[model samples]
Each structure stands twice: as C-alpha cells, then as structure tokens.
Target chain A: MVSNTNELSHEAFLYLIRQSGIDLDTGHDKELFDYVKSVLSSLDPLRSIDVGSTEPPMMFIPAQEDV
Target chain B: MTDVNLCYASVRALSELVSKKQVSPVEIIEAHLQRISETEPVLNSFITLLADEAQEAARRAEAMINRGNHLGPLHGIPVGLKDLFNTGGVKTTSGSRIFDNYVPIEDCTVASKFRAAGAILIGKLNMHQFAYGPTGENPDYGHMHNPWDPEKIAGGSSGGSGSAAASGQCTITMGSDTGGSVRIPSSFCGIVGLKPTYGLVSRNGLTPLSWCLDHPGPMVRTVEDAALTMNVISGFDPKDVASARVNIPDYTENLNKSIQGLRVGIVKEFFDAPLDAEVESIVRKAISHIESMGAEIHEVSMSMFEQSQAISGTILMCEAAAYHRELLKDHAEELYAPVRLRLESGLLITAADYLKAQQARALFNTSVNALYQTVDVLVGPSQPITAPTLLAQSVEINGTRVGTTAAVTQYSRPYNITGTPAITVPCGFSASGMPVGLQIAGKAFDESTVLQVAHAYESTTDWHLKHPDIAS
Candidate 1:
C-alpha cells in the first residue's frame, strides 16, 4: 500500500521495503524499522512550511564546454 | 628543533625553513612518520600508512629544492588524505571493508594537485563508514580515538583527519563535509577546519556520500595552513560538472587585514536549540572577544534555520541512495549495521518529499542570505557539546537527553544547506579540557572574509597554539 500522506505509516513503509527487494534480517527487523522510522519522523516539520511555488534548489548547472 | 616540534610546526613555519634550506624535506617526513608510529597505537587515525612513498616524495622534493626549483609554501609539507580520495595504484577503502582491495588507475584531482605542489602523501586517514555517521564509529576498522582523550570520539566522518592533525601525526589533512564532517572534528580535536564555498573545491574523485551536499575542505592545525592549502586546491575544474567558473583569489592575501567595522551576526535560533552550559558560555565569550576587536556584533533571526536538518537530510538521503542503489541491492549485508539502515531509509524517501525539502531549502537559503545583507558573517557554536565518550549512546544537555548524532550535526546542517563558506576555529576548552569551536560563516563564495574574520580571532587568542599532550 502506497502512503497517501507525506509521513509513511509502519505498514506502508514495510510494504515499500518489501517491494524494494531488500531482505531484512528477522532478528534485526524491529531495530531496522525503528531507525528508518525515526529518520522519516525528523522530517515531519518540513511538511507544514508553505513553499509558495518556489523552484527546488539547483544541484548543479551544466558547463557549456564539455570535459 | 626536536622531532616533536618538527611534527607540530605549521605549514607556514615549515615552508620558510624549506625555502631557506634550513630544514630538508627528508627530516620533516621522518619526524611525522616517527610521530605517527608513536600515536597510531592510541589514535588509530590512519588505515594506510605511506612511510615509503612519503620518504620517496621528500627525497624528490629535496633534490628539486637543491636545484633551486621550489614549488611554494606547500612544498615538502606532509598531508594525509581521507581514504575516500582515489590514489593511483593505492587502496581507497573509504572506511569500509567492501572496498578494501579497490585501487584506482589515476590520482584524484585533489591528490594530483597536492602532488604537483610538492606536498608529501603521509597516509590515508580513516573515517566513519561511507561518511554516513557523525561519530567516528567504524567497526570494519578500529574506531578513531581522540588525541585529547582516547576514550572520546574524534568526530566524523572526517574523524581520522581530525585525530591525525591534532596529534601531530600529519601537518595538514583533507576532510569532506556533507553536513559537518570537517568542522565537527576540527571542533572536537582542537584544530582549524574550513569548508570553502560549494564548488570552490572540486569533488572530482571523492567517494560520494551526497553529490549535492558533499564539499572537500582542509583540516589543519592553523588558519594560515588552511589558506595555503586552499591556494593549491581551489579553482575551476573543467572536469567537475559542478565546479564554478568564478575567478579565484589569493586566499592568504587578505590575512592580517583589519576586521574593523566588520559586522558579525549571532543567530538566535542557534542558541534556541539544546546546548551545553559550557559550550554556550565559551561561544558567547568568543563573540564578545570579536566585538573587543572592533567587529560589530548583532543578534539576527532566521526561523528557517531550525528546519535545516529536514532540508539537508532529505536531499542527502535521496542523492546518496540514488548513487549507492546498486551497492545496497547487491551487497547490503556487507555494510555496517547503522550505515546499512541509514542507506535503506533513503530508499523510502518519496520523490515528492525530496522535492518538497529542496523547495524548503530554497526558502532557507533566501532567509540566510538576507542576514548576510545586514551582517557580514554569522557566528555560533560549531557543535552544541564537546566530544562525547565512545561508550555513551547519547549525551545530556541541560536537563534533556539527546542522541549524540542529532546534537553534533544541528549547527552544521544550516551552512551546508546554504552552500556558503563556513570555518571552525578553536575558541576555548570546556571544564573537562575538550575544545569548543566558534563557527564563522560568510556569503556564498566569499571565503576571503570568512578567513579574515577567523584569522583575526585566532591571532588575538592563544587557543590555536595549544596542542594535545598525546606524546606524553
């Protein structure tokens, strides 16, 4: 099940990881899931900000002269 | 001078000795090698020691100087590169066992530049595995031990660079910062680390952690040594697609210039975060010290600064995951546990969230740049606390407990988000004797002013003059 909201629910996250073809060790599954969940949770505040049509920041600009 | 003194001498001091033929390159290399041997047992700073290559390079440098063919300040100086940099025919593990046998056919641009400048390659320093974690906890190799206190972390992902420079195992070292890898270690190890403006230094051959956020920089014992290193490394590289074509200036030319009437801003949000009592006191005192030097200090607010981790983390994870997609799929189990989990987390970040984070980053950059319009630089504590003990999973700040990684990278992520030049200089020491760093950040690509401000503060204080007593 794909996540409808910005935050991924535990079931949705597990589904996505399962789809990713990454096998989580049974013994460490709980530990691994919690770690990823914490990382996602930290970004929760970003969803509330109003970006106002601003373009995403440029990562790099291509040089005219080829290397 | 004794071997101990020779090992700790700054590049500027040793450059003069080399130029005047008072000290041969061979003697300098020997001193550093001897120091490395003594400190390696405790520091665990280097994964690959290049004593033979360093001596050979020193001999070549001596012969060239004998023929009156000097290469300049960096000539005959010793430098250690983080293992991420690809060196021809030499292993570049990047702090992981997976790449233990990987060797490159050609030298990375940075390594080649240093070689051309006649800097001896001392060794390849260790780091956090794949430059993922903030603490120097690498299970594949021994954890990087602090020169000040072996029980404490040296700070990562540039942990080994920090330990080596502070312990006098190398005169100068290179560190790459995605968030605060360079400055964090510089703070914990009591040294100078400078992350030049994004695109100021090329990332041509560095192992990528995050393509957009990764920045190669200098971690050294003094500000002038950083400037000297920058002179050789900073320039437009046609090969690097992200390399800026802006005119490069002599980074050392503005040193010793008066910082009178210079405006320095203190971000209110920086202090609003969780902070240690001693760290807050030391950073504020450093600000007052700058004011005493005729620099105007102002309290500024950038509300978006608090959201920096979200913005930087999102982009970093997506890019890092995209780059390492195959590696994770094919060899996930080979990675360290924490690093493996972090990389897997990146796979879960939706494209929408990644883009949303970048949009927020655009706003964050706008807010920070506006502050520079009012103030020449932003000043704050480099890390909220000093180096944490390796045995502890988290540290207590005030009455609250916070994870070590979160606390260390809090202040560092903002500068990386802005892609501006930021530097960390030792301001003072905590009650327990760990060093505190005062960060000075300037407008994008304006490293000259950043260096000027840091150099001014460094020259007026005795903080940078102190070294770890690891040898004793």
Candidate 2:
C-alpha cells in the first residue's frame, strides 16, 4: 500500500505540489511535476511510524524553557 | 577597499574602524544602504530598508563615540532583521498581507538586543509567508532572489536573511528556523546559519510557526561571525520560558579549539540517500577536511530520521492549526495558496495521529541520545541539491524528481525534533556555480562543538570569502 498508493504515485504526488501552491506550469515541466510528486510522497506524516496517545506532540513553545 | 567594504570585513573590523575615528557610523551605514539599493532590485533580499533611521542611528553612534561613550561589541555595526520579528511602531508584515499594517508596541527580544548592543538596524528582510516555506517564495511579498544568480532562489523561511547576508547587505542578519528555515537558506545562499539548540534564544515577540520548533539564530558569512552575533542574543529571557538558564558561553571562546580525535559520525542513512552528486561531493570533501583536522569519522545510522520528519511535521501542522484555526477560517481566501493549503490540510489530521507522532518523538529522542554517545557530531549535506532555478518549482536529484519543499528540508528537520543544534556553512559550489552547504550537527546543548567544527572548516576554505558579483 505504501508503494502503490496514488498518494505514493508520481502523479498524485505532483498534485500535492500543485495543491501546496507553488507557481509552476505543470504542462511544460515533466521533471518538476514528477519531482514534486516524489517529494510529497516522502513527506507523508502518516507513513513512517506508529504514534501512541500517551506521548505529547512535539512543538516549539514561545515561553516553555524546559520543553 | 571596494571589495573589502562590500563584505567579509567582520563586525569587529567595522566597529574598530568606527572606534578609531577612522570611519564614521554614518559612512558605514550609507555604504551598506547604497549596496542594498544596488542589490535589492536584482536580489530582492530586503523587503524594507530603514535608510532614514539607520542613517540617524549611525549619526548618534558616531556622536557617542566622539564623547568617549562605547556601547558594546556591536557598536556601530550594520545588520538586518527578518521582518517577522516585531519592531515597535514599525509594520512587521511577516511577508503576508494579513499583517501588512500590523505594528507592535514593543520590539522583539532579539531586535532589542541588536539595538542595545549599538547595532544599527538597516531594515527588515523578507521571509516566507509567516516563515512557513523553505524556498522563500512569498506569493504576497515578492520572492527574494539569489544574489549569485537572480533566477535561482535564496533559501527560506529565512531567505531574506540568507540572501542579504550573502549579498553584502549586512554583516549578519537575524533569522528564525522552524525545521531548517535558517540553515536551509544559508546553505542555498552560501553563508553560515546557526540554528542554536532550541531555547538558547528567547521567542518573545518572534512570530510562531509551530509553537515548539521555531529557533531564532544569526546568519553570517562565517562561523566566527555567527558566534560573534550569537553571543549577544543567546541566554535566559524572562519573557521566554524556553530560554535556557544555563550560562551562555562566550561563543567565540571555542573558535580555535582543536578537534583532535573528536568523534564525528556521518549518518550513512542520510548521506547514502539519493542526494545530488554535487551536494554529495562537497559534503564528502567537508567530512574529509574534518577528518584531516584530526577528527575520527564513523558511519552511524538512525532509522528515526524519517520518523522525526513526520513527527515534527505532524506537531508543526497540528500546532500551527491551533494558532491559525480561527484566522484560517475567517481569512481562508486571504492566505497565500500554499500556506492556506498546508494549514487547512492540517485540520484533517485526527487527534490520534498527532498523539501518535508525539509518542514517537520520545522514542526518537532517546535513540538520538544513544547515537550521540558514539559520536560527538553528525554531519551531512545541508540540501540534497544546490539552489534550483527560480523558475523551477521542483528539482531532480539522484535521478528522482522531488518537490522543492521536501528536498530542501528533509535533512534539516530531525535535529529540531530532538531539540539539538545544527549549523550550515558553505562547503563548496556546484559546477554550474551554485553553492552547496555542509551541515554540522552536534549533541543536545552542544552548540559549542558544532561552532568549533564549522569555524575550522571556514578557516581552511575561501568559500566564505566568495560572494555574488551581481554587476558585470
């Protein structure tokens, strides 16, 4: 599923780039289109590992020195 | 003098000349202002230049020195601040139209530090919309171009800081790195950017991207210069609880420290990836240079690097949504398309998913601490590729096309998750003449070691001395 999902496919990944709002003429640049797709697939936050409910979400706290 | 005056004459050099009465602050500020004007049209690095105020401040510094009054290490120095930082009574647009006219009643801690050190604020540098993007392409505020090649990008969310520092607009510029914003642009623009260990600098009055991942640090042409600037801004802040209570070391104190037999580990998983040949070559050279300097190199692996990126992204998106939830709903149509899409998509992430990411964070941080026991530093290519053309929305590296965002940021985000420090310095340029950066990452709260290694690389190479000759 990880390898075959359109979310993982080159084309759907390209769509993610388009959705991200970078200005590009998708018609002319096949390389960019494919590349954007590849990059997006890699960025899927859902794929890498299993998360548990007990852990606190990582974040930058403006005032939390110990965080 | 023409070339030397352009840049690489340290803040110390400029301040000393001013101190000796050999050069007036007014003259230094005017020179930088003229250079900014000369380069802005081509590089678009500075969104705003406070020519009037800078000149006025310079005049005062000159008057003070004449009366035998000295402020500090930054006296009479010219530097730039990212527009995202709050400046009392000045519009801090954050490169977004939403805050176009927004002004604050107080200056950000970092900005005030610069002001108090007798540093003259040249003006505000542009950034990615709300410091969200890595490529620094601001749909609202026009993109800041690379000084070396206008068609190529200056890396962002600290794009302006990177471009301005590289283009000689300032001796140093303040930038915030949330997932490599500071270091990424510094790498692409061919300068040194220090992403201090989280909490080393105060976040008060600095705009938030993700509540936990944002780090404010200095970008300069050299590691020594970064150390010089960092010494002033880093330390405990009552306004920022995240500011560490630990003593802020004299950053320059370790500049010439020997790394003889220091354990430097190269993350094979990271460098072994499909990185651009040019980037890999320069990175290998940097590692070799470090090894030659009496450091031992070992191959280290952590499967959690990818995991860290995801967890960091999840936390970033979820936390970002928390900040923008209301604003995004009301101003959905107003957001620059990419930022809106990112913030909006973040809403789809379930609470379970966010918690999962967080739990994984504790596991990953523990694993990283284990890796640190085996090595004092981890090094890698800052970007998978050099600066892509401004026209390129994505680039191909190692034969795989990757989107601009992921390719630029993948290597830099993990350190953010582990709350460790990372710095990027120009290693070399590609064949097409674009620069590549080597990132030196150290153990938690071990910024002193990272700075030492970076400063040593800088001492051995002239890459830091090179700048864009914008005009023929």
Candidate 3:
C-alpha cells in the first residue's frame, strides 16, 4: 500500500532514479524528483482501497493457442 | 450550397449528394480544402495537409461513382486522422518533432479501413505531442486553437481532430482516446466523439499511448457520422492482439431507433466531484431531456469512480514510459517538456505500484459492471468546464482551483479504465458561448445503444447544427 502521502526523501529519490537505469542530469534532479513524488502521491489514495485477491487483468495468449 | 455551408454539411448529407450524383467528389473535397485554407490560419489543426493528394483521390472517386460503382456512406467523404495514425507514404509525426521525418510504408488498420470506405484523406491533424496531455499545447507543433474562440484551447491529444471537425476543415476526424483524448476535445469543440469498447476497434496502425487504454474512435459533427465511421472500423484485426472477435454490427442500422425503454443512470459522484455549476446544470437538463424521451432515469452510486484517475494514471505512465524508454534516454530533449517530464516520472513507478494499480483496476471494472446491471448507460458531463485558455495552468470550478489536467480529465477517465463504449455529444453551450458536452457511457460493446441515445438527444437539440463563426 502506498500509505505515504508525503514526498520521498532526497536520498531515496536519488536511489530510485539510479535504479531506473536512465541517466539523470544532476542539475534538474530537484524538479524531476518533485515530479516523481507528485505522481506517487497521486497514487497514494489507491493503496488504501483493498483490491483483495483481484488479478491485475493482464492477459496474454500466444498465437498458437487459437482454435 | 455555399462553400462554407458545404464544408459544414454532415457526412450523411454529403454522402447522399455524392451517391445521387448531385455533387461530385471533387466538389466536396474542393469545398473542404477551401474551408481549410480559410481556417488554417486560426485553427492550426493540420500538421500535414494532403491538398494535392486529396484532390487526386477526389477525382478518382468522381470517376468511380460516375461509372456506377459507388461505395456507400463514406465514399468521397473528407476525413482527417490524428498524426499518430500511420498513413502509407505520408508522415506520421504523433505530434512530436522527434518523428517530424518518420513515414510508415504501410497504412495502419484504421487508415486502410478509411481508404477502403472510399474516404478522402485531407491531412494529418495536429495533437498533444505523443498524445501525452489533455490540453492541445504542443511546443513541437503550435498549440491547437479552439474553433469557438481562437484564444482558448482545443482539448488535446485529439485536439487537432477536434478542431478540424468543428471548424469544418474535415467531415470526419479520428482521435485516439487513452484518457479522454477523443471525448475531451469532442466536448470542448462541440462535436461528437465516440470511444468504442476497449477491443471493438483495432489499434494495429495507431501509435501507442497506453496499450491497455488506447482507443481509436471517430470525432465527427453528428452522432450518425460517428456511427457510420464505427461501422467501417469496428471488427477483429489479426494484427491487433487486443482486437475482439465479437460479431460486429452495422452501427447505423439502428441509430435512428427509439430509446423509449432505455435505462440511463446518473452517477452521483459525477455531480459531487469538482464540477462547474453551469456545466452541471447543462448536463442535468440534458438528462431530463433524455427522461422526457421515455427513458427511465436512475441515480446509481459508483464510489470507485473517484479512484479512476489514480488507476489510469499509473498504468498509462508505465506503459508509455516502457514504449518510449529509448526515446527518453536518447532524444529526451526533443520531446515536449511536459511530455518529457511525464515519461521520466513513469520510470519512477515501482513494479508493485503498477501491479497494485492494475489490481485496483480489476475491482474497479467489477464495480462498474455491477452498476451497469442496474442501468443500461451512465450519463454525465463530458468535462467540468468549457475550453480553458491555451496553456492555463489551472481552472477554478465551484470556487476550487484544480490543476488543468486533473480538471479536464476528471469525468472522462472512468470509461477508459472500464474499457467500455462512451461518447460525448454537444448538449449545450456555456454562457461564454463555448460548447458543453453530455457524456453517455454504456456496457462493453454497446456502442449501438450509446449512439442511439446520443443521436436522439442530438436530433432533439440544435447544438450540433451551430457551427463556429470562424468557419464562415
């Protein structure tokens, strides 16, 4: 659950960005970090909703499966 | 008819004229070309206008019809495709400078369908870069201007399609709706935008916004025109994995049918959300009109509607980021800034967050399905407000200032998540003279009913007949 509505810590933000594998320009990290935090914050309310055992609805059937 | 009147004529009217030999295809194409030339300065609707090619095609259509080999309704009808649709031998920019030179060798499925229907391709309409934002502000190409007032925005990602159809630059334009892209512009521009059920229309040739959410639909001046376009485009395509194998109906066959016993639901959350008082009043009156037409109106509660934005945003961000990961890494600076930032933000979404959002989506769909059992369709305002001024950061609705993106998309995103058929028809105009939209959503693959209700409402009201003065 995305319980935290607050922005991510600066270090955690950097770590995530590092883990993303996309090279970052250090100069714009502040703005980029804030943007990412806002996006996460937007999804925070979603975490509180109990989806229970519902599947992700991601389905993929190979071409060979056709009747 | 005068050039302007001819330009503003509906596809049905033009089709009759073409089929009856009262008007040549060349005349129809020329009339629209003339209209486009007059309005292009103000609308900036087309990224690539295929003037010479359209004229040539019109001539060929004229020859075929004269020889008694007439194609049905869409034959010789002028249409514009949002730049994301792949047109063989023509540039498909997706409204970004990064693809300013990209041309596909083969037509996308929809484009080929339009061609098979004998429709004339006037040009590629402009859009929000890569179909990213709701407002048609593209730094790569110029921002799309509203037909009602040149100063306000034409709603985006399908902004160009919206403007083109509204301004009479094209009889029918296609827009891809991920989260309100088609309906948003349709409402803002005073046209009909129909987003068919998730798999009803194929996305084989369209550039992906969010594969799971992307829907290619028709943005036209009338409800019947949208139905006509659907008749041509809706079906299974082996190339599109998401395409449904369901039996496709002739959408126009029952378009004029009665909705006497139709059960229309009004989601309480639609009004309870941050909505403009005028927009609310207009939509309420629209529902009452539907009731007056022998339809039963019920108030249904779908509290999960509130979670639509969060759910759709997460999935779209992840999908779009994954699709453009290489572009973000290499040509990052070339993308429109807002789109760039949005793509980067997606890279930050955790796998848990993505999966959680999807899980929430499954539940959300279940809740929506349960509500559908209670009613045949849900009715709401297509947007909270009329078109905002170009690049306005926020719009105040009911004394609350909300971010523009959130406000524009608030009511339109729920159907995208459900992947159901939804449409926006011109209900009324705001006091400021901008158009207001009445959105109607139906059960999955129920576009016929949705179109029926919208056509009934549209025929009862003169809203669709009022063209922007700019077109004149």
**Candidate with the greatest TM-score versus the true structure:** 3
Report the C-alpha lDDT of model 3 over B1-472, residue by residue, as the tens digit. Answer: 4343678888888988889898898999898998899999999999999999999999999999999999999999998999999999999999988899999999999999999999999999999999999999888779999999989999988999999999999999999999999999999999999999999899998999899999999999999999889999899999998999999888987778898989999999988899999988999999999999999999999889888999999999999999999898888878887898899889888888889999999999989999988799999899999999999999998889999999999888999999999999999998999999999999999888899999989999899999898843
Give a tens-digit lDDT track for model 2, residues B223-316.
8788888889988898986778888889889999898999998987787655998778888988999999999999999778766667788778
lDDT, residue B416, model 1: 90
Candidate 2 residue runs with Cα over 4 Å from true position = A1-54, A57-67, B1-6
List pairs with backbone clashes in candidate 3.
Answer: none
lDDT of 3 at B159: 97
- By TM-score rank, best first, the candidates go 3, 1, 2
Worst 10 residues of 1 chain B by lDDT: B1-10
lDDT tens readout by residue for model 1, B30-114: 9899998888999999999999999999999999999999999999999999999989988999999999999999888999999
Best by lDDT: 3
Local error of candidate 3 at residue B2 (angstroms): 7.7
The lDDT per prediction is 0.90, 0.81, 0.91
**RMSD in angstroms, all models?**
1.9, 5.3, 1.7
